[model samples]
Structures are given as C-alpha cells and as structure tokens.
Target chain A: MNRLSFLAPVALIGALLLIWQGACSILHTPEYLLPAPTAIVLALILNAPILALSAWRTLAMALEALVAASVFAAVLALLVSLSRTLDRAIRPLAVALQVTPVVAIAPLVVIWAGVDHPDRAIVALAAIVAFFPIFSGAVRGLTSADLDLERLFDLYGARPWQRLLRLRLPSALPFIVEGAKVASGLAIIGAVVAEFVAGSGGAEGLAWRILEAGNRLRTAEMFAAILTLALMAAVVHLCFQALEKRALAWWRGR
Target chain B: MTDVVAALLAVEVDYPGRGKALGPFDLALVSGEIVALVGPSGCGKSTALRLLAGLEGPTRGTVRRAAGRGETSVVFQSPTLAPWLSATANVALPLELAGVAKAEARARAVEALARVGLGAAVNARPAQLSGGMAMRASLARALVTSPRLLLLDEPFAALDEITRRALADDLLAIWREARPAIVFVTHNVEEAVYMAGRVIVMTPGPGRSAGETRVEAPTPRPSGFRTTALFRDAAEAISDRLAAATRAAA
Candidate 1:
C-alpha cells in the first residue's frame, strides 16, 4: 500500500508529461511559445553545464538565506521570550514587514545592498521573505511551554537559561522544524523574484537564466529552468521533512 | 515539636477575573509527613497546592516555603514528562538544572527510576510509555532531587484502579526511603485516606478548610489495609465532609 501510494504521484506526473508532449505535437505548436516536454528535456541536456551552474547558484542563495533567517529569527524570538518590552517592540515591525509584499521591497533592497553585489541583495530579500515563519513559530513555541512544566521548573527554581535549554527549546523543536519547512520554500521564491527585480545585471541564478532565455525566445530552456527550480524546492522540502522525522521521532510517537 | 517544612498563613488567592478562588486558608506541613487535600472540582484545591509549591502567591495573605533550589518537586495529573527526552533524561533534568554533573545526575536518575519500577524503561520516551509507566517515570523525576516538599496535583487520577493502587503503594515505599513532606490534591476520598495520614477537605470554589480527618495507620501500611475498618471509617468521614461542603456551596 505504501509503495503504491508513493508510485501514484510519479505515475500522475508521467501521464501529464506524456499528454503535454502529445498535445504540442498534435497542435503543431511553435517550440519558442510552448515547448514540448521532449523539447525541454533536449534543452536541459544541451545546456546542462550552464543550467547546472545557474541551478547551483540559486540553490546556494536559498540555502544561505534560509540559514541567515533561521539564526536571526531564533535569536530575536529568544529575546522576545525573555523580555516583554522586546516582544511588544519587535512584533509590530515583524508583522509590518510580513504584510508588505517582498516584491515591492525588492527594488529598494537591491539598491541598498548595492548594484555591485546583486547576489547579496537577492540573498537579503530571500532572508526577509523567510524570516517571519521561523520568527513567529519560534515565538509561539518558546512561550507555549506546558503550564504544568512551567510550574515544575519554577518549583525547582530553574534559572531562565536552564528552563530555555531543557524545557522551552526542546518543546520548540517541532515548531521550529515546521517553520523551517515553510521558510525553505519561501526562500527559493524570494531568491527567484529578487533575481527578476535585480534585472539582467549579472545575477546568475536560475531565475536569471529564465529571463535570459525568454528574451531570446529560448522557451525550452525557460521550461527547463522552471523544472529545475521545482526539483530543488521539492528536495529542500524533503530534507526538512526527513529532519522532522529523525529529530522529532518522539513528537510523532505521541 | 514537629519540624514545620512549610506553612500557608491566612493565604487567600483572588484570581484576576475569578474572584476569591481560595482561602483565608491555613496549612502547615510538618517534615516527613504525607497530607492530602481533597475537595470537589473548582474547590481551589489545586490553588492550595500551587501555594505550597511556591508556584503562585496569595492575593491577600502569606505563603511560606523553606525549600530552596531543587528542594521542591511537583507532579501534575498528567505525567508531564518532556516527550523529547528519554525517561532517564527527564528524571535527571531537575538535578541537571541544579548544576549537578551530567554523569552523576544520570546515574542518580536511573536509581530513582528503578525505585519507581521504571528501570526497564529508562531509555523510553514519554510517548512510548503506558499511562502507568509514564506516571512512574514522573514519580522518579519528582523524587530524584529528594525534595523537602513533594507536591502532587492528582498525580494518579487518570490511571485505572489497579495501576492507581500499585502506584499508591510504590509511592509509600519511596516515601519511607526519603521522607519528604508529601502534599497531594485529589477528588478521591478513598485515595486520600489510603495515601495520606491527614486528609484536609475543602469547601467549593473560593475554598477554605471545611474539615480534616486523621487516618490512624502506620507509614507504609500493611497489605490489605485498604479493606480495614480504620481506612473505611476515615474514607467515609472525608466523603461526608466533601458532600457537606458541596451542598453548602450550592
């Protein structure tokens, strides 16, 4: 049953790709407009080296952004948990940043991060996009410790740091893992959208490749790049899912 | 004179939004004695336990707890073990929090777990344990520190009768070894009479002490003591007081 469940999605995707390829051929569609699955595969093989480099660049940016966002959010969440004043001060700003579209802010971020390092700007924008989930999830997780356990800790006269390390942080693990899963997807998207906003200014991620391909009507290459992005996102998601399973075995056992 | 481990002096707690939850109540726990607080739901019995554990302050009176760091331990109705940790690790936490070395704490935790009949399940996560086993782990965690004040808020209320009876006996055994001033809150009159020497019955919400029954049985009473006339009489007396308190409130 488990094997069949796993095979179902693969089978569905294979069928869809076959249908798409057949439709393009039957309609005599132009390759530059709507590239067939076969044409995209050919483009992928033809441009493997360039596509691989660009894919790596994009993946690296997303990963770097994810790490930065996770660290910053964790520290900030810790501060918020420690101090009511900090929580009151930072929460509104976090919400405001979250509510404002990342696209609208990308241009300003790119310029401020400096035109010379579009890579840095893309990473920064991605980090911003990835920040809120980790921050909010961590905040909720840290503060949402079991009340009975809180009293137990108090009875022991546990130091603040001890409570955090032993109780709050362990309780927060499932939540932080969940936030990271959501943030991983957003980081990829933010990097791509920031690449678009960064324009053709030497930023060399997969999104840049897509833009370059589209301008030259290399639609097959564009499709190939999109497929690569999807694969990367799926892989990243799976990594976090595996982590949640391995590190939080006890949580699921409950 | 008995060594007074802690006292609640005219402690009245008025929870914000829920006025007059407990007391002007008074309680004095003597060292190495087991007392049970029994009352109906919303009788502020838990509030009184919190007061003794130093988890909450009185709104209008004083709570005196002499216990310092790692000197008080509490077990709630649920096991309240950290699900991420192994049973040994959970038991070791209070000692670790008190700056004990990890090796020493873990070794001591294993010993404590063994005392509570959880030696075989030391590495099990809380989620993996049956309710009875989980509560035993909780007992180990509570006793690992050898606390002067051991507070239990219905620690075995969720267990089946057999498990509950077994735990009650095991707890008494551990108490014999290291006699902390045990104060547990429960709604069960028979359990109160069985486990504690003195059972203090409280009035309904905004509770004050309604009555007290002293069970004349030895510490770690002999097997089948629960069926004895002494236990029966004490249980009935407390049950009558609880019923009267509930009736008066209505």
Candidate 2:
C-alpha cells in the first residue's frame, strides 16, 4: 500500500511532464513564454554550478533563520508559560508580528539593516515570518501539561525548575516539532521574498537569479531557478518530517 | 497504635464561585494503616485525597502532615505516565527531581517495576503498554520513592474487573511490604472493603465524612477472599452507610 501511494505521485508527475513536452513541440511554442521541460532541463545542466551555489546560499539563510526563530520562540514560550502576566503582555505583540506580511516589511528591514548587511536583513525577515507558529505551539504544549501528572509532581514536592524541565519541556517537544514543520517552509519563502525586494547584486540568491533571468528574457533559466526553489522547499519539508518522526517515535511507535 | 501520619482538622474547601466542595469534617490517617473514602459521583472523595496529598489547601481549616513532603506520593485516576518516557524513566521521575544520580534512580526504578510485575516492560513507553501494564507502571512510580504516605484517587476505576482485582492484590502485597499509610478514594464499595482496613463513607455534594466501618477481614487477605462471606459482610455494611449518606444528602 505504501509503495503504491509513493509511486502514484511519481507516475502522475511523469505523465504531466510528458504531455507538456509533447504539446510544446507540436505547437512550436515560443521559448520566452513557457519553455518545455526539456529546455528547462538543458538550462539546469548548463547553469548547474551557479544554480547549485545559489540554492545552497538560500538554503543556508533559511536554515539559519529557522534555528534562530526556534530558539527565540522556545525562550519566549518558556517565559510565557512561567507567568500569566508575561503571556498577556507578549501574546498580542506576537500576533501582530504574525499578521504583518513579511513582504510588506522586507524593504524596510533591508533599509534599516543598511546596505552593507543584506544577508542579515534577509535572515531577520525569515526569522520574523517563522517565529509565531513555533511560539504558539510551544505555549500550547507547555500549558497542556497533564493535570494529574502535575498533581503527582506536587505530591512529590517537585521544585519549579524541576517541573519545567522534567514535565513541561518534554510535553512541549512534539508541539514544537509540529510548528517547526510549518515554519521551515515559511522560512524559505521569507528568504526568497526578501531576496526579491533586496535585488540580485550581492551574493546572488536563487530568488535574485530568477529575477535576473526574467529581466534578461532568459525564460528557460527562470523556469530552472523556480524549479530549484521548489526542490529546496521540498527538501526542507522532508527533512523536518524525518525529524518529527524520530522525535515522536514513542508517540508514533515507528 | 502507630503515630498519626496526617490529619484533617475541621477541614472544608470552598471554590470561589462553586460554593462548598468538601468538608467541615475531620479525619486522621495512622501510620501503616489503609483508609478508603467511598461515596457517590458528586461527593468530594477526590477532593479529600487532594487535601491529604497537599495538592490543594483547605479553605477553612488545617491539614497537617506528620510525614514530610518527600515522604508522600499520589496516584491519580489516570496512570499519568509521560508518553515519551519508558516505564523505568517514568517511575524514576520523582527521584530524578529530588536530584538522585541517574544510574541510582534507574536501578531503583527497575526494582520498583519488578515489584509490580513489570520488570520485562521497563523499557516500554506508555503507548506500547496495555492498560493494565500502564497502570502497573504508574503504581511502580508511586512506590519507587518508598513514601511514608500514599494518596490514590480511583486508581483502578478505569480497568476491567480482572485487571482491577489483580492490581488490588498487587497493591496489597506492596502495602504489606512497605507499610505506608494510604488514603484510597473510590466509588466501589467492594474495592473499598477489599483494600482498606477502614472505609469512610461520605455524603454527596459539599462532601464530608458521614460514617466509618472497620473491616474485620484478616491481613494478607487470602486469594479468592472477594468471594468469602466476611468480605461480603464488610462490603454490605459499607454499602449501607454509603446509601444512607446519599439519601441524607438528598
């Protein structure tokens, strides 16, 4: 059953690509409009080194931003769980950050961080976009500590720190992993969008490569770059899924 | 008689908006004695257990514990095992919290699990265990600390009849060996009489102790004792008190 489910998507993608290639050839389609999969594949082979470098840069930035967001979210969640006052004070600010689109704020972030540190600005933007899900997940997990377990801890006279470490943190892990799966994808998006606003000059991120290709009317190259970005996002998501399975092995039993 | 392990002196609990939840009553638990609190659903049997465990403060009066905080343990209605942790790790949690070295705590946890007949399942997480096994793991956790006083709130209420009887027998064996003062809360009159030396009946709603019955059944209560006439008589007497208490409350 699992093998059939896995093969189904691969088969569908192959059939769609075959049709796209056939249609493009029979119609004598212009290359600048919608390049055939073959043309995109050719572009990918020709610019393999540069595209690989750009993909790596984008992946690095997204990963860094995700790590920073997770750490910041965890610490914030710990504080929020520690006190009701902190939760009341910080929850609105977090909500505001979440609702505010990263695209709308990216330009301002780049300008504020100054021209010398475009990478920092992009990383910061991605971190902001990725922060809320992890924070909310951690808070929910922490607060959901079992009442019966808490009472047992009370009976044993567990210290506050002990309770936080032994009970609350372990409970929060699956939730944090859940949030991370979502935030990992968002982090890549934030990085790509921020790169778009910042322009392609320094460090030529994948997003910048796409914009450069578009301006030069290198449509096949643009398609190739977009494909690279999609692959990067898929890889990031798959990595997180693997991590979730490992971390929650006790819950999933596999 | 042994010294008093704990006492509730004219204790009553009132929720801010929910009125009186329990008491304006008193009781004492003697060292090495097993006491059961039994009543209808709405009665504050659990509330009384919470007071004894020091999980909640009485609204009106004092609850005094002769045993120190570390000398008390509680088993709640659910097993409450941490899903991520192995049975040994779950059982070792109290010792770990108290700063015992990891190896030492784990060794003690293994010993406790063995006592509950869960020696082979020590590495299993809660999800991997059957209902009876999970409850045994929970019981192991409670006994691991060798507490001077143990508070249990309907610990067997969720189990099948066979599992419940087996666990009750296991609990009796552990109690005999360890001799902790125990306050067991349950709605099962048979269970109350089967496990406890004294059964304290409670009135319904704004609960307080209505009456007490001493079980004359011999110690190390024989296997198949549940079918015996003596056990039935004790259960009947406690049931009568419980029925009267319910009627009086109405």
Candidate 3:
C-alpha cells in the first residue's frame, strides 16, 4: 500500500504531461501561447550552460540566505524565550515583517545596497522573507517543553544553560526542522523576486533570464526557466524532508 | 536520631488568584524512610511533594532540605523521559547536568538502566517503550543520581493493574537497595500502604495533613504481599482515614 501510494504521484505527473502534449498538438496551439513539453525540453538542453549558471546563482543566494536566517532566528528565539518582555516587545515586529510584501521592499533594499553589491540586497531580502517561520517555529519549540520535564530538570538542579541546551534545544529540533522546510521555499522565491525587481546585471539569475527571454519573445526558454525554478524548489523541499526524517527518526507515526 | 532529609513546617502554598492550594501542612522525611501522601484529587498531594522537592516555595512558613540541589530527584506521574533521547541518555541526563564527564555519565547510566531491568532496552527511545518500560526508564533516571531524597508524584498511577503491581514491587526492591528518603504521592490506598513505611492522609481541598498511619508490615515486602491479609488491613485503615479526611474537607 505504501509503495503504491509513492508511485501514484509519479504516475499522475507523467499522465498530465502526456495529455498536455497531446492537447497542444491537436489544438495547433501557438508556441508563444503554450510551448509544448518537447520545445521546453529542447530549449532547456540548448540553453543548458546559461540556464545552469543562472540556476546556480539563484540556488546559492537562497542557500546563503537560509543559513543566515536560521542563525538569526535561533539567536532571536533564544532571547525571546529567555524573557517574556522581549517576546512581547519583538514578536509583533517579526509578525509585521512577515506580513509585509517582499516585492514592495526589494527595490528599497536594492537602492540601499547600491548596484555594486546587488547580491547583498538579494541576500538581505531573501533572509527577511525566510526569517519568520524559523523564528516562530523555534520560539514555540523552545518554550513548549513539558512542564513536568522542566520541573524534573529543576529538581535535578540543571543550570539555566544546561536546561536550554540539553532539554529545550532537543525538544525544539522537530519544530525547527518543520519551519525550515517552509522557509527554504520562501527563500528561493525571495531571491527570484528581488532579482526580477533589482536586475542582477552581471549575475544574471534565472529570474533575469526569464525577463530577457520574455522580452526577446522566446516563450520556450521562458517556460524552461520556470521549470528550473520548480525543480530547484522541489530539490530544496526534498532535502529538508530528508533532514526531518533523519533528525526525528525517534518520533512515532507521521 | 536519623537525619531529616526534608521538612515542611506549617507551610502553605497559594496561587495568586486561585486562593490557597495547600497547607498549613507539617511533615518531615527522615533518612532511609519511605513516606506516602494519599488523598483524593485536588487534595494537594502533588503540591506537597513539589514543596519537598523545592520545585515550588511555600507562600507562608518554610521548607527545609538537608540534601543539596544535586542530592534530590523527582519522578512525575507520566514517564517524563525526553522523547528524542534514548533510554540511556535520559538516564544519564542528571549526571550530565551536574558536570560529570560524558563517558562517566554514560557508564553510570547503563548501570542504572540495568538496575531497573532496562539493560536490553538501553538504545530504545521512550516512544518505542511500552507504558511499563517507559515508567521503568523514568524510575532509572530518577535513581541514576543515587539521590539522598526522591520525590515521586503518583509515578505508577497511570499503569494497568499488573504493570502497576510489578512496578510497585520493583520500586520496593530499589528502595530497599538504595535506602533513600522517599516521599511518594498517590491516590491508591493499596499502593500507598504497600510502598510506604508511613502513609500521611490529607484533606481533599486546600490540602492539609489529616493523620498518619505506620505500616508495620515489614521491609523487603514480598511479591505476593499485596494480597496478604496484613496488607489488606493496613490499606483498609488508611482508606478509612482518607474517607474521613475527604468528608471533612467536603
């Protein structure tokens, strides 16, 4: 049953792609309106070098931003967990940052960092987009330790730092991993959106390539770029899923 | 005179908005003695144990402990083992917290697990253990430190009858071996009488000590002791006091 469930998604995706190709051929759909799967694949092969480079840059920016955001979130969560007053003071600001549209802020970040270091603006913006899930996850994780366990630690005379490291941190791992999975995808989106708005001159990220392809009326290449972004997001999601499985191997059930 | 491990002298505990929770209670635990606090729910049995464990402070009066911070331990009602850690690691936590080296702590933890008959399940997580095994692991963790004072808050109340009896026997054996001053809290009249040398009955609400019963049933209580007439009589007497205390509180 489990094996069949795993195969179902792969089978469904393949069937959808076949139907899409068949419809495109039968309807004589214009390539500009909807490129056939073959055309997109061909474009991907033909433009592999540039596409790969652009994909690499975007993935790198996303990854760097994810790492930075994780550290910031962990430290901030620790501070918030340590003091209720700080949590009350700073939590609303974090929520505000999370709710604001990243697209609106990308242009300002680009201007602030200047064109010489557009990468800085991209990283900053992506980090901003990625920060909240991890922060919220970690805060909830750190503070949600069982009251009995906390009292047990107290009775054992665990020092403050010992309690944080041994009990609180381990208890929070599953929550942190869950949050990171959500944040990883957002980090990529943030990177692409920032690139689209800021124009990554020499860097030429996948988002910029998409803009260039669209301007030149290369619809196949545009679709190819979108495909790469989807693939990157899938790979990021899968990696975190692996991490969650490995870290929480002890957890019972789903 | 035996050493007094801990004492609550006319101690009362009050929650800020919830009025008085427990007390004007007086109790003293001496070295190598097994004491049980028994009453109905909301009777502050746990509150008294917490006070002795130094987990909470008395609102009025004082609580005194001869055992220092690292010399005391508690086992809660549920198996409070860290779900993420293996049984061995959970047992090792107290020593690790007290600045013991990792290697030494693990060595001692293995010994503790073995003492509780969990030697074969050392690598298993709490989630992997049955209710009986998990509670055994919790007991190992509490006993790992060889604490001078051990406070147990209804540790076996959640187990089934067979597991509860088995665990009760295991606890008696462990207590006999270690001889720590123990304050066990439970609502089970039979368990209270079987495990404790002295059972202190408490009123139902805003709890206070009602009376004490001395169990003259002898130590190293045999496995079949629970069904014995002497055990039944002791349990019956404590149950009668418990009933009166509940009625008075009502």
Residues B1-250 of candidate 1: C-alpha lDDT, one tens digit per residue: 3888899999999988988899889999999999999998898989998888777888888888777656888899999988878999989988888889999999999999999998899988888899999999999999998898899999999999999999999999999988899999998888898899899999988999997999889989888998898988888888888888889989
Error of 3 at A127 (Å): 1.0
> Looking at candidate 1, what is the lDDT of residue B101?
99
DockQ of 1: 0.64
lDDT of 3 by residue, B1-250 (tens): 4889999999998988888889899998899999999988988888888888888999999999998888888998999888878899989998988889999999999999999899999989888899999999999998988999998989998999999988888887888888889899998988888889999999977898889999887777866887888898889989899888877766
Give candidate 1 regions above 4 Å deviation: A1-11, A250-254, B66-69
lDDT of each: 0.91, 0.90, 0.90
- Rank all candidate structures by their TM-score, best first, as comma-separated numbers: 1, 2, 3
- Candidate 2 wrongly placed segments (more than 4 Å): A1-4, A250-254, B247-250
Q: Which candidate order results from sorting by DockQ in descending order?
A: 1, 2, 3
Q: Give the best candidate by TM-score.
A: 1
Q: Which lDDT value does model 3 have at B164? A: 93
Q: Evaluate residue A143 in candidate 3 and report its C-alpha lDDT on the 0 to 100 scale.
A: 96
* Chain B structural similarity (TM-score) per candidate: 0.98, 0.97, 0.97
Tell me the TM-score of each prediction against the true structure: 0.94, 0.94, 0.92
Selected candidate, larger DockQ, 1 vs 2: 1
Q: Model 1: per-residue lDDT, tens digit, A1-254?
A: 99999999999999999999999999989999898998999998998898889989999999999999999999999999999999999999999999999999999998999888999999999999999999999999999999888888887778888899988998898888889989999999999999999996477999998899999999999998888888888998899888878767767455
